[model samples]
Target: MMKKADVGDKTKTFHKGQAIYKEGQSSGEAYIITQGAVGLYRLAGNKRVTLALLRPGQIFGEMGVITGEKRTSEALALDYTEVIVLDQTLLHTLLLKSPRPVQIITSYLVERVRALNALVPERSSSNTFASVCSVILLAWRAAARSGPKSEAAQISTVELSRTIKDILLITQTEIDEVLEKLARVHIVDIVDVKGTYYRTDPLLGTKKKSGEFVKERLLSIPDAERFARVSRNMAQDNPDANGAELEFIDLDDFARAVDAQPETILKKIAYGEVPPALFHFHKRQALAFAASKGQDYFQRAKRPRLKVEDLQNVDDVVGVDNATLEEALSRLGFYKVGVLAALAGDEARQKIYANLSKKIASVVREEVQRMPEPDPGEASDIEDELIGLIKSIKGISG
Candidate 1:
């Protein structure tokens, strides 16, 4: 018989301006906002952008625990906030037994996948144009929120190009051509500053100020028309996309919503496995690999990509015993260790390599302490060389 695990109840409170979790920190707990509001934000360039606000009865900080990844963003209290914490054990137990929890998780995952799939450009030129236009409109609306009062929103072309590239799997040339088309149509005014910037007036022209400029242009554009049709199809399959509110995420990011390994998921698709229903492609392969097994295989084949110590930090928050945490973490996926070796002078990068060396030594000591083994002289030398290289780079950068 399997034993039921004991997960203690833990509730925490935070004052306004206090961080519930910092970006890059390890997390194994999901928090439900019980009182006041919580702010969800991520670093945008050099600034912090509030992605969303969680009010009473809303949930936050669940992604990290579910995906077994470090925090991708920071969460702070917008005001005084109280949260009920559900540790990993409890969450896994609920996942196995509760339909409600599964449904909530599925909803979030499906929503994210749909958003990602929609960004994939259709082969038709018109459809590609529509994707670009839709992206521009989205950026324009974002700029409007920043209090631009001249009826025209100033959008940095470089930033807009980056946004389009991030959201859609498109090349720079495609994006540039789309911008040129919009400029020719008088829909967007291209201005040169330090970089190319675009000024788009949502209420441009009109003999009557009918407030239909945007709608009319969208209706007339072959690409925009195709985009709306595609959006309708997406809505039919994903109930979350049926309404006015929509959130977009990159294809890689969709994996985080479902607690799956991002690279593993991408690899499955790359190898011609059947994607989920939210994807536009029909399931063509009956014997396709499963995501769970794929992740397990990937981990075994790869070197440590992220810091193992950071993973251990997550276990600390969950209150898992050291032995158990080590055993569990030892089996998880890691990125290739030497991939970052070429990068120089980053403090964070240096610390990661240093920590990797320490973790390697600690694991070897624990596994061989009671057994007769050869001296670790060769392994120690390798660690020393790696550490020395990092220190040299740091010295130069400093």
Candidate 2:
């Protein structure tokens, strides 16, 4: 019987055939087999393809641990085993804290790779076409994860070739050959001259839209009506509903309440009718759905109505101090005494003058453009008068 040595730090016992780590899972830690054997394998051709077997004093999962790559193989314990699990975070800290550990890890990985190569020769030539196909499939999955469905499903062979070449250090000719084999097997549907491939059927190699593929394609539509309907429905089902309820506001009610032009709301909703079941219609859902349609239902509903008191308040003018008035006028651009007097009388003076100033700025800009240079004397007089008018408006003699 082999004596089991206790590697006290980060060691855990696993039952026979128990999964230690799975492929494609986030690599949070690396493991060193201490007391038992472990098998590394990947799913290939619907069969478990054994990649390697590890005994005591062997390090595995370093590829993903170092590069932050996804795990490429599943590790299963051969029997009751004790393994040392090193935390990736701690490992990184250790690498930074001491250079020696980093050097040791790097050399260890190199030695492991060389040893593995002696057993399994780099997988460069064996079934090169199949490997290429695998690369394409990986690319497709990656694109689907990152981009819109329609974009992901309709990948060009040229693009796939470029990506494969970059990632796998393979030739375009090899990628092309693999693509042809993939197309021949019907794992991917190839569009002639366009180089587009769609995963039609997984097993029979039939070209068919996957559920996710269908959903993604539908969502990619500029105006997805199904999404809108579902969104609207979802909004209506909520109990603590704000503004007008969705059920209360029918198609006609929505149009009238919003005061939109004839057929505008109807036409917008009509465009979203293609996949009605796909969306959950709710308030937020409706808003998001109608966003592309340029409808502002919530904004219209939330618009506060002006009252008589509000108007009266604007008309009622209270005397403002000269310094305050002068500063406001200087910053805001008011020149004529008459204009200031009119503004002072109106309680909505700020609002009115703001609008007037905008117009004045536009006119001044045009005049400046027409004139080669402004008259210094005229400019000085205008400035003085502007200041005086501001002071007077505020009822200050200065």
Candidate 3:
């Protein structure tokens, strides 16, 4: 029988299929699987892939909780299970007081390390060091992000992979494959203990850190020069605009508008430092330049996408009864239905019948019947046409 002290803490119960904790959340405590089972999984590519399953007597989350790291994989209860929660502080204190506890923890950590080594391929001596460096760099960034708050100075593999994918413009699989190759050379250490953490020697070959390597690659792009030139030209043209104006140019205006700046604007621009052309800025160069330099420029504001809540309000106003408007909004994408419903008073609905087509209008009419009768100003025809537009756009059955 397990002693109360050996359990070290109280057991928490979870139903089958319930989430014990999600991936990416901060690790609060580790768990000992006292009864039932739990499955650990992470998002691999587009799918949730199971990394491991724990049965009775096995401990999980020790690596991350002890190290104060973010969870890499989600833990889901495989059945009605009871888990003994081991608070990091309390566990550490207990471990210090008891030789038996220290031994247990040491054995657990060793077993975990051994298990990870068996699962991951060993790094070889013959592999390209450059690729190995890249993998190590990514792994370092990931560990930095996922490490504890005190060591919060770390990055997680997911974040590192995302940055590399964006900078290198490669898929996750491509990044994973590169890491796998580097893992073969032992240049990068990939550990599957708790959340996957990576470690690498930055001084292995290159003097440059991973960040410097990525920055160098970015600066070397052919478009980098062109983007810089265009941005400088735009800045010169908008000499009157303040630095903030240049920095916060709206997307639409940034692409097309060009106009002279006022004296006051020029004074502000003089005080402001020119911002660097980063990846996102480079992608929207035309927009950024236009907003900075174009005369009579107006940046188009992005409209909020319509949501289910919008449809519910429309249903309340229109006298549509019976069917829940929320359900209808889901069937017809919210924005599509909301934009059409907004046209309830338009004159075009009545005159544009033949142009709009009957099938489209019929669906709109059916939906409107659920809502309350429109006010005197509301035109049923316009509402019908709006529905028609939605059906046409979504290819929904009229």
lDDT of 3 by residue, 261-304 (tens): 33333322332422434213334435866778675655553323
How close is every model to the real structure, measured as TM-score? 0.29, 0.27, 0.31
TM-score order, best first, reads 3, 1, 2
lDDT score of residue 352 within candidate 1: 38
What number of clashing residue pairs does each candidate have, in the order they appear? Answer: 3, 19, 34
Error of 3 at 238 (Å): 60
Badly placed stretches (over 4 Å) of model 1 are 1-8, 100-398
For residues 225-341, what per-residue lDDT tens digits would candidate 1 score against the true structure?
Answer: 343455445334433221122234434346656778766666445334545644632122212434435656655544234332322211111222334333433332232122222
Candidate 1 has a TM-score of: 0.29
TM-score between model 2 and native: 0.27
State the lDDT at 13 in candidate 1.
94
Evaluated at residue 367, the lDDT of candidate 3 is 57
* CA RMSD of each candidate after superposition: 21.5, 24.0, 21.7
Model 2, CA-based lDDT: 0.52
> Which 10 consecutive residues of model 3 have the lowest summed lDDT?
212-221
